[model samples]
Target: MAPTESNKRLALAIIDFLGSSLKDGTLTADDAESIEIAQSCIADTFKVDPTDEAAVKEAVGGQSLASIYSVYEKLRSKSTPQAGSASTEQSQTDKPKTGAPTAESDKFKSEGNALMSRKDYNGAIAQYTKALEIAPGNPIYLSNRAAAFSASSQHEKAAEDAELAVSVDSKYSKAWSRLGLARFDMGDYHAAKEAYEKGIEAEGNGGSDAMKRGLETSSRKIEEASRGTEPPSEELDSAPGASRGGGGMPDLSALAGMLGGGGGGGGMPDLGSMMSNPMFANMAQNLMGNPDMLNNLMGNPRLRQMAENFGQGGGMPDMSSLMSDPNIADMARNMMGGGAGGAGGAGQGGQGGQGQ
Candidate 1:
């Protein structure tokens, strides 16, 4: 007797389960037996041999039962051909069509991140630029590019890119941080402080400690600059053998040496020797003589704190009281030909005390 429609559907379901198990390498002995029993109820349920590799390969041909069922269902939905009509055959096509460009953009973004991790800032910038070109207005891509720009020392461009990133997504803390640093380098301390503060506000209490510290430091510099002291200079002459006096130009190699050479020995200086050096003593005297000098040299908070600590030590003369002493001040001015001389020199007052 011919099989009923329900029986054929049952046979197909069993074939699908068996094929899936075989493809996934999870077919048990019981499942194999069930497939065999189900196949016996239908003449052409599945042609694949359960154990023979060549027969399975030839019969299955890498096609899942679902694909076969889909085609079968499509064929089943069509009307029967008329008698004596020309022969008709169905052709099945299963080619996967191309999708949208998101995959490519994602690929470029991943490559950019990898380059960034390796410190290849220029390569990272190029990759991120490509990603942005593919999907413009992506906040993450814009922010990543800004980081690369900042790493490359393109501070102005970095600031612009960071601004764009934050405009795209105001909650991007990293972009705000980059913008703050760039603005600070450009001498816009107030704007830098504001950017950092806004970032902290947006990020809540969990914001970065580094950003908070940076904001504080910049704010201090701004306050100090506004106190009617000397205007900022670009000199580098405070260090021995430096040419530009009192200008705050940084020497990278000298700083590196101060930080300890690449070999990483005990890189710190001998503070005891430095304290005992006459040159350092002269520097201290000079620093005290000109209060405005402190504004420039004290830009580094740690160094300023150290200088203040030194000033507070016992036996250090009170600068304000010394300045108020007319006899001492007049004698000091005369001794160095109208310049402020050392405590006791020829223009002559009695030697006050060792503390003086």
Candidate 2:
């Protein structure tokens, strides 16, 4: 059979490609001599000049020979062998098998990850779905798809995929973390907390910092719901003396003075009246118990100065200064209940009673 014009052109293109590989350093200096020799041999056999720009262009047909060969390889890999007559091998080749990642499935997963990096959640989902089709019970694929779903704000679908992933492999900590995040986004705090706990258990070495933080946040939310308190907003708009529109810190000016324990009169004020206010009492007790809160308080130079002033009977610490510390501000918002009481009169009378 005579070689077709296209086949001749293809051979020319191969020779041209080999020359290019050497020039472009694709073939290292060590292999340059061998590559040049191979290119000359191919050009001689094909009766083509690989260095002839016009001939090379015509042979390449606007696309590189490497690209064309890549297409050929892909098609060959996907092609299944046919049998003259039906046989067990033929039947098995036709039969669809699913489970575990194959090379083909892994390629899809890599594509999905690339799409995810580009924030193409829909495209990533499609690629992940293709991978899952080839490997149905793959926890990693399911977890990746779940992350894509979550990124797209499809919380329900994300939760479902995450749950399936965890069910397939309970020890998959990332899957459990995804499940917890999905639940948390859906406002299912208790469920989120449980999932985070499971994730922590799955991670033998005390779990990742992110997982532990998620667990703490979920637990805080559950506690807030039970205590009928709203989580602190990003901006603490309801500080002391701010108009009480459903939420605000109570006036702590007098309580601050009492904490200082009266100076000129020289005696500690009776704390009975101050402790009677549930908001004040609860906050005081919680603040005293919280090591983090105490540490933050003691670490702040301004706060420590205010505390010293109170001890020297310096009256109320400046509300503005006290609220400036974000830790104290958040604590005040989270612990303070919506209640009002006359602490000024209480402080004065308690001071008098103690002085007598």
The prediction achieving the highest lDDT against the true structure is 2
TM-score of 1: 0.37
User: How much is the lDDT of residue 283 in candidate 1?
Assistant: 47
RMSD to the true structure for each prediction, in A, is 25.8, 21.1
Residue 278 in model 1: shift from native, Å?
40
lDDT for model 1: 0.58
| Top TM-score prediction, candidate number | 2
What is residue 298's positional error in candidate 2, in angstroms?
A: 41
Candidate 2 stretches greater than 4 Å from native: 1-97, 229-356
lDDT of 2 at 295: 30
Identify the runs in model 1 with alpha carbons over 4 angstroms from their true place: 1-101, 227-356
Query: lDDT per model, in order?
Result: 0.58, 0.70
lDDT of 2 by residue, 235-258 (tens): 654332212223333334434543
Q: Model 2 clash pairs? A: none
**Count of residue pairs whose backbone atoms collide, per candidate:** 2, 0
